[model samples]
Target chain A: MIVADKKPIEEIIESVKEFKKILILGCNECVTVCEAGGKKEVGILASALRMFFLNQGKDVKIDEQTLERQCDHEYLEEIRDVVDQYEAILSLACGVGVQFTAEKYHSTPILPGVNTCFLGATEQRGLWTERCQACGSCILAFTGGICPVSRCAKRLLNGPCGGSSKGKCEISKDVDCAWQLIIDRLKALGKLDEYEKVQPIKNWSTDRAGGPRRVVREDVAL
Target chain B: MLAEMEPPKGVDISVMMENASRVKGEIDAFVVPEMSNAVMRMSALGGALLLQKNGMDTVMQVCCRDRNRLALQADLLAAGASGVKHIMVVTGEDPGFGDHHQAKAVYDLTLLELLDAIEKMENGHDMSGIDLCGSPQFLVGSTVNAGLSAQALESELSEMNQKIKSGVDFFITPPLFDIASIKPFLSCVDLSKTPIIPTVLLLKSLGMARYMARNVKHVHIPDELVRRIQNAPDKARECVNIAAETVHAIKEHGFSGVCISTIGWEDKVPDILKNIS
Candidate 1:
């Protein structure tokens, strides 16, 4: 899932301060799961903004709404009638959702209230860890399912560099050495031989090095 | 025959130059390390160039920790053009180990990929397959961890073989206190084709020895040796004797050569090599 973190309340206040009427928009997708942007968060933000403006003795109208998924056009159209009522939308969604909302409603200003972090999983209730880089090419079969591109400090294909000590990365004791994990997993599965085979120089063109990318699926196109 | 020399942390190279001149006739070449342990310093290329200008042969170490492929290739070209013939490629220590904890590590190319890029440049093409007007050739050397455990030794040997296949001319092992400790590595690699130069690191004190033994990954400092340093009345002299003895033992074991790393005690390098000849 796309993980995100809420922006500081001060920054959110400053961004929406210029507008007299504001809409606090939230996404019910990945942002909701990560606890960054959701229906509950939208209500909390709206109440806070109302109190902030009330304390300043200003007449500001604050409204809250959360779509099923902000990226989808059908769910976004549900707010078409009310979107023009507000001068700006403080979107508590991923960057993708904010941009999609802006594209759908050309006149309204869409401001991101959360920082989209990475494609990751919730390690526990309130903790998230990155798992993939969306590098277009995957090599998990050889590496025992651990993603070096996302995990390793160096992203070394042939690794466990000399800095790996006591199964921890040289960067931090908190971060586990990705190569150590790969080696341990391979050893457990009796597939240590896979590590012996040299992984060739990566063709990075398939990665972000290739620049902004797009996928055109003729079969799935409407 | 190679003695490791660290570049000065700041601009002044007078001390470094003086140390190199002290051991100029005694050692074959000075291996200028590139920010080993991730501590920032003047680049190895700059120090190597200074020594090269002073008519001393140098093995300038290059690591994939700091530079991207373009910068690496550019520096390699600079090294080649400036008459540096030996290049030791290492995947350097991570940035967190050094002073700059927040600096982003740029391992844009892996060890294998960087080696392949060097090979490509030698063949008159860059990594992008663009033709080069002049190709730079180097005697490439890389480090191999001489792991003690059976699993680790197997993995090291496999990586060593891959390094050899990648056109590494020779190999250098991490510091070894006991000669018998490298028996596993010795049995695996045929040192005839690609000579392995074992490092003889100067153990400054018992504390350093204990620290390295406990914290360092591949380095193995024996308990007996640490006790010897602990027992010695003059511990400094004892440390020098231990380093010199390791070099002598390396020669007796029939390894091609030895790399003496003084680890900031550069003045003691002459002392370490004095009895070897």
Candidate 2:
């Protein structure tokens, strides 16, 4: 899921200060799961903004609404009639959602209320760890389900670099060395021979190095 | 024949200069490490240039951990312009091991790509395919880890082949105390075609030897050598003697050369080389 974190209340306030009427938008997707942007978070932000404005003796109107999923056109169109009523919309969604909402609404300013972190999983309630870098090319089959591109500090294909010691990265004792995990997994699975094969230089063209990417699916096109 | 000299952490190069001058005529070329162990220090290029200015040959080590492709290319061109000839590439230790733990690692190019970029610049074009003002020629070298296990050794050999294809002039292995330990690596890689220089690290103490043997993967410090250091009356002198003996053994085996690494004890390097000659 796309993990995100809520922007500091002060920064959000600074961004939406000039507007007499503002709407705090939230998404019911990944951000909601990560507890960054959701219906409950929308209410909390709206209350905080209202109290902040009340203390300043301002007559600012703050409204709150959460879409099923901001990335989808149908959910975003649900706010079409009321979007123009507010001076600005604070999107508590991932960067993609904010951009999509901006493209659909075009006129009103779409401000991001949460910082989109990465494509990761919730390890526990509060702990989220990154899982993939969307490098476009995947080599998990050879690496025993570990993703070096996202996990390794150096992003080394042929790893664990000399820095790996005692199953931890040289960077930190807290972080588990990704290559160590790969080697151990391979060893356990009796696939240590896979590790003997030297991985060639990765073709990063499929990655962000190739520049802004787009997928054209003729079969799925409407 | 090579000695590893780490650049000083601060501005003062008095100790570094003095150490290099001590063994000036003793060794072939001083291999100046670039902030080795991810510790911040004077840039390797700067250290190499200073040594070169003093009429000494130096192999400047470049790591892909810190700089992007542009910065790397710029530094390479700078090294060329400054007349520092030999270049050794390494995938440096992670920044977490260094003082600056919060710094971001910019590995824009893999080791092979960086080598390819160096080759490209030598061919009179930058990584972007733009023509260079002038090409910088260098004796390119890189490090290889000859693992303890057969599987790991095979993997290293395969990568060594790739690095050779990338035009690496020489290869350096991790510190080796026992020649028998690297027998697997020795049998697999032919020394004549591509020169392999094994590092002879001067163990600071029995604790360091034990720590490296247990903690540092890929490095194999023989039990007998560790016990030898343990039983010595003077540990430091014993460490130096062990280094000298390893260098002599490596020479006897008819390998290309040996790189003597003193860690921070560059002062003891003179003593290590004294017995070698």
DockQ of all predictions against the true structure, Cα-based: 0.02, 0.02
What are the clashing pairs of model 2? Answer: A171-B96
lDDT per residue for candidate 1 within A151-196, as digits (tens), equals 9998999977889889999999999999999999999999999999
lDDT of 1 at B158: 83
**Candidate 2: true contacts recovered, fraction:** 0.00
Residue pairs clashing, model 1: none
Question: Residue B260 of model 1: what lDDT?
Answer: 96
Over 4 Å off, model 2: A1-222
Candidate 1 CAPRI classification by DockQ: incorrect
What TM-score does chain B alone reach in each candidate, compared with the true chain B? 0.97, 0.97
What would the DockQ be for model 2?
A: 0.02
lDDT tens string, model 1, B121-236?
Answer: 99999999999989999999999887555898888788888988898998888888887777777787777766989999999988998899899876777888989999999999
Give the distance in Å from residue B84's predicted Cα in candidate 2 to where it truly belongs: 1.0
